[model samples]
Target: MRELACDVAIIGAGTAGIAAHGAATKAGARAVLIERGPGGTTCARVGCMPSKLLIEAARAAHDAREAQPFGVVAGEVRIDGRAVMQRVRALRDDFVASVFSGLDAIPEELRVTGTARFADPTTLIVDDHTRIAAGSVVVATGSSPSLPPPLRPVADRVLTTDTLFEIETLPESLAVLGAGAVGLEIAQAMTRLGVQVTLLDPAGSIGGIRDPKIAACAASLLGDEIDLKLGATVESAEAVGDGVRLTWRLESGGQETGTFSRVLAAAGRPPNLSGLDLAAAGIACDEDGLPDFNPRTLQCGTAPIFLAGDANHERPVLHEAQRQGWIAGGNAARFPQVEAPPPWPAYSLVFTDPQIAAIGQAFDAEEAHDWIIGETSFADQGRARAMDRAAGLIRVYAAPDGRLTGAAMIGPGVEHLSHMMVIAVQEGWHAATFLDRPFYHPTLEEGLQSAVKAVAERTGGTR
Candidate 1:
């Protein structure tokens, strides 16, 4: 067997693994990156980039259809599903190639093209042929879609984020399972693309928004474009002809059934640690098989071993994965002298039409009792009205001292607006600070000014 040595060995070449590899090398540590498949990250190959391409196409089609309401008649719009999908795949391949170009620039010997298993705390066996003796290991194996129990039997009939984009043609009808970010985004995009889409979620909210007011607004707006079955649980799923039939229990004590051309399951994602042989490395895992790790440091219970990205299951988004990778790689390079940096404030955004975003404390947190709330409706906002998207709301929260604590919004531009709140919460900015900044009129941002000022006034600040 071939033998190699390195200061740090990164498993999986996804977003986190790639970031860790770069950080370790930049920190003067000899790093080796291992992977079993093509080296493109998930976002580039499947998750974010390709999905956004499809959503953009769907949005364009939807916008053209809705243009008639503005007294500007657009001729009959027809969607060419095959052409749309081909374009997505073409652009997706280019993204994957770009990622490969970076990987190729790395020394060839440092890239291992095989699955790795833990032989010991500081040793990795790659495909039983080569052994790597590393001072530290960073596991960033990412995650896989989680299929629910009822859908397992008909798994072949269900599509996931990992497989949905590979379809040659869009389904005429789709029943989307789960109302989280993936489910809601795809449901809206598919609906706009002329698919009969029915979205089912056991939770009461859409896009995982915990605020009842915002959730209700999201449901009403999205439901207007598609069939949204909130507070509905899938009871059974079975193969029906070439498709699948699903029976679900509604919140109102009624059972409903639906058969669709396809079922896209966006249930959730679980850590991908199936065959890593982690026990050999003496890593302790929880009931759900997740390794215990420090959220701030990204280090596992075992010394010299760290978990980053979706493998830790702390924060599964791409940005969090990148941050965790940098921390884990730097700490792994330093080993026993690991540094713990202060954690960043939490922020998340869902790119559904009338995007949903949350920063810092969630809308339904118990601590909100001590925080003053301010809100604005987008129904009358000038920009929203002009764009024919005047159908959402924004809510901001501030502490007793008027410092911005949290904010959640469901509106046309909340994806970008949420970043403003992220900076406010992270920098300890007061509500009045937002007022001091100039907000251009007739923009969605002006609505945020109103919300911020309302919170400032409630906290006894000068209007």
Candidate 2:
């Protein structure tokens, strides 16, 4: 067995791990980055990249099917799942390659690979064979799809997001368990590809984290094709012949059973910390495998050890993990006194057929700030009306003095719109500045002008 030494050791090479490695190395610490997998993130491999590609393809197919609405007559549109999957695989490979290539420039002293686990707070055991000693260690283990208790024993026909990507063929009918971002994104993507989909959620509404009005718009966009089974308690799940059976109790106290060619378990994600042996490292874990830590520093219960990303459990998103990892990595390398890290940025996005993005405090205007709310609907945007894609709204929360506090968008361009909101939230910019900036006319972005003006008007002035 070989022994290695490093100033800091970072386990896992996903978004957070990579960010930490970069920050640690830049901080003049000798860092060792390790991963059990040979390549880059699951996001690049199967999760975000491939899934989003498939969703974009599904959107194109949906547009073709609705050609008549655009005054363009076209023949029947059909998607070859095999071909689509092939393209997705190619894109996944390219993304992974790009990530790996970027890592090559990091100093040779700062990276290593193979399965790594804590032998002690400052010692990492690699591949169950080699041992590496370090001044500090940062854990960035990511998460895996959560399997529902009742469906745990079911086999084959039942799948999760991770398993679904490797499927040989798309099922004719799919029943998705959980109406969170994962379930809705996949369900809608599949529906556009001609698969009958049913979405089930325990909450009364879909997109639990989103504004209810935005979720209603999503429900409307899905039309009669996607079934909504809200406030349903799953009773049992079992495999029957080539399909699976699910019996659930509805919110009205009625029990119903349904069968589908495939059942997708998209019920959030559980942290990937089972093998890390937190006890040996003197780290404390909550019941859900999350580490006890300071939300600001991400330092675990013990010294010389920090946890970030999905393992820390504060929030789960690439951006959040990446930022937290940088803080943890820098703090671990610096060891004792250091400048205070920035407060965690709160933002989330759900990319369904109609995207929803939100950042900062919501529903806490009085507590967060003395405020005025500015709002605009997609219906008022020229580009939205011209594309016939208007199905949502944008709202900005501002202080009585016009300082922006929060921003949310639910409709086309929402993903891109979040960047502008991020700037406003980060800089504490005046909401009225958006109106004076002058966006190009005949575009969705011009809606920001309307939103800003509405907020200014409410705050006792018109921009």
Q: CA lDDT of each candidate? A: 0.89, 0.79
- Candidate 1 regions exceeding 4 Å error are none
User: How many clashes does each candidate structure show, in the order listed?
Assistant: 0, 0
TM-score of 2: 0.93
lDDT of 2 by residue, 1-463 (tens): 7788988899988888888888888899989888887657767876788889888888899889877878999898978988877787788789989988888887664567677878888888888667999999988988888878888768556788777877766788898999877788888899999888888888876665455555566666654457888888888988888898899999999999989999999888877888988888988776766777888888875488888887777788787888988988898788864335777447878788568777776655246446677888897688998888876888877878887777767778888777778777787777666666757778777776677778888765563
Q: Candidate 1, after superposition: displacement of residue 57 in Å?
A: 0.9
Worst 10 residues of 1 by lDDT: 360-369
Reference-based lDDT, residue 303, model 1:
74
Model 1, residue pairs in steric clash: none
Candidate 2: 10-residue stretch with minimal lDDT: 361-370
- Tell me the lDDT of model 1 at 51: 90
333, model 2: CA deviation in Å?
1.7
lDDT of 1: 0.89
TM-score of each: 0.98, 0.93
| 128-168 per-residue lDDT for model 1 (tens digits) | 88899999999999888988898998989989889999999
